[model samples]
Target: MSDGDPADDIMTATYRALCTHGYADLTMQDIADESSKSKAALHYHYDSKHDLLCAFLEYLYDRFVERTSDPAGADPAAQLRSLVQTVLDKPEDDREAFETAVLEIRAQAPYEPGFRERLTRFDDYLAGEFERLLEAGIDDGVVDPAVDPADTATFLVTMLTGAATERVTAGRSVECTRRMLAEYVESHLLTDATEAQL
Candidate 1:
């Protein structure tokens, strides 16, 4: 690698390669080309394409956590909106390709234990975060006390996953889903007083 950390360089390359070729058609050579490293170097770090992609999934999850784990707003309602927006936001240039690649990987999760395990971690972590936010909102008198945090968290996570998948598979716009989620928050989750503030 260049003077920097090789692993970081490789992960960046993997992301680029995935965007360009997508998971179904991706190869180690594609990653090597993006990284400017030899195929042997790629293999030195990963035994096979499957292994490399498994590691890449973990890396992607870590980056997702880093980007989203911080609370961006003072109020729980604002934080919920921020979190959902972050999930739906994508860079304009590679949005389609990158989302397609991720969808391909998610599709493979059904048959691939490694992928299933990694992807499950994403769902579990996101659900936990959602639950935490809902509980906080209730405690602060912003969310409806009748809302069950666990159930609501699961519903929100499922909604998000559906939005992501529909965007790639059906060429659906996520903005509609985003609006629906916002409406759901305003009507279903937030207290009447909290809704007025929003």
Candidate 2:
């Protein structure tokens, strides 16, 4: 809205700077240097780093929703597999910085209400996805009837996000985690009826 998407440019620049310097070390000048926007334009759009970072965090979650939504007509169990694989896939060198940046943003959630709001919304995306998948699986007779959709949804998100946290913070082996998740999903989440049928 303000002068030919300068805000977008600034946000893009901010993202680059964020991945490079991380949240703690990133500076306005760094963002400015990365952007085509002038320093004044950057200031006009975001007066402070916290404001910019909150926007950045929101931007990331929004991008995730846009990119990761399961394909239409995919089986619910397959959708669940896709979701698990998406989170559990091993980190590529290029993504390490961005993944680290996401965790850095997550650490701010407890203290910053605005940041917390965006994070909650981001979580809703996963939770909602889990709910839909759980419903579909139940309807299709793939997931166990005894499993409560809401509880399982929470559990799936927790497992996925916990894996993400470990990947960034503790250098967890994603291959190991993915194998464990697949086994757990098969043995626990998926219905015995489906297994017997197979």
lDDT (tens digit, per residue) of candidate 1 on 59-178: 888878976796588888788878888887764444688889988999999999999999999999999998999999999998999999999999999999999889899999898988
Give each model's clash number. 0, 0
| lDDT score at residue 46, model 1, on the 0-100 scale | 97
Model 1: lDDT to the true structure: 0.86
lDDT, candidate 2, 19-72, per-residue tens: 899877888888888888766777788878888888877766766776568634
Q: TM-score for every candidate vs. truth?
A: 0.91, 0.86
Show model 1 residue runs off by greater than 4 Å: 1-3, 91-94, 193-198
Best by lDDT: 1
| Candidate 1 clashing pairs, residues 3+ apart or interchain | none
lDDT of residue 182 for candidate 2: 80
What lDDT would each prediction earn against the true structure?
A: 0.86, 0.75
Candidate 2 residue 142 Cα shift, in angstroms, is: 1.5
